[model samples]
Target: MEMQGEERIAARRDIVWAALNDPEILRQCIPGCQSLELKSPTELSASVKIKIGPVSASFSGDVVLSNINAPESYTISGEGKGGIAGFAKGGADVILTEDGDDTILAYEAKAEIGGKLAQLGSRLVGSSAKKLAQQFFADFNAAVSAQAAANS
Candidate 1:
């Protein structure tokens, strides 16, 4: 599945960029995230538990940042294995554009799933994925804005 959207965060591009790279911020922003640990500057290990329709699973994966352009854009990709439930893999191209004191964050994302998840039907899986993505960005925007306010 594929999705794209943009959010106007009430913070500077640099602050937003830093928040994007911070594991603590990401851990809070990612829906269902149980834990997130930075393995390196460009890599992280994460565990997330999710429920789709009637299926629930815990996924452990490694997320990597690539095609990086500091404070501007990057591609974040990861794949997770959920035992028998299935596996999910995807990537997102994120771009940050400055607008006054705020930052415009845009992203184009694509995902693929196999096993029981794929058996759940495309409509169900697609809608759930969209909702999860929306939640993540909304949480991220709130976190960044709050952090910016606190710092200022």
Candidate 2:
């Protein structure tokens, strides 16, 4: 499925980018995120718990950031295993645009699933994926906004 959204964060692009790259901040912002570890400047490992339809699973995987453009845009890709639930692989292009007094954080992502997850049908998987993405963005925006407020 494809997912996209934009969030207005009350912070400079540099500040926002720093937060985005910070694993600790991401762990807190990611919904159902059990853990997030940065292995390199542009690579990370994570585990997240998710409930899709009637199936509940925990997925762990490695994510790599590529095609970097400083304080602007990048492509992120990852492949994760969900035990009997299935496997998932996806990539997203994140773009940051300058907005008055804030930054417009936009992303478009494509995700693919296999194994039991693929057996669950597209509609159910798609809806759940969309919800998860939205939740992550919402949490991220709130966290960043709060951090900015506190720092100001």
Best by TM-score: 1
What is the number of residue pairs that collide in model 2? 0
Tens digit of per-residue lDDT, candidate 2, span 45-137: 999998888888899999999999988999989999999999999988999998876999999999999989898899999999999888888
Report per-prediction Cα RMSD to one decimal. 0.4, 0.9
| Backbone clash count, each prediction separately | 0, 0
**Consecutive 10-residue window with the lowest summed lDDT within model 1:** 113-122
Top candidate by lDDT: 1
Write down the worst ten-residue block by lDDT for model 2: 11-20
Clashing pairs in 2: none
**Using alpha carbons, what is the TM-score of model 1?**
0.99
Q: For residues 98-123, write the lDDT of model 1, one tens digit per residue.
A: 99999999999999999999999999
lDDT of each: 0.98, 0.91
RMSD of model 1 against the true structure = 0.4
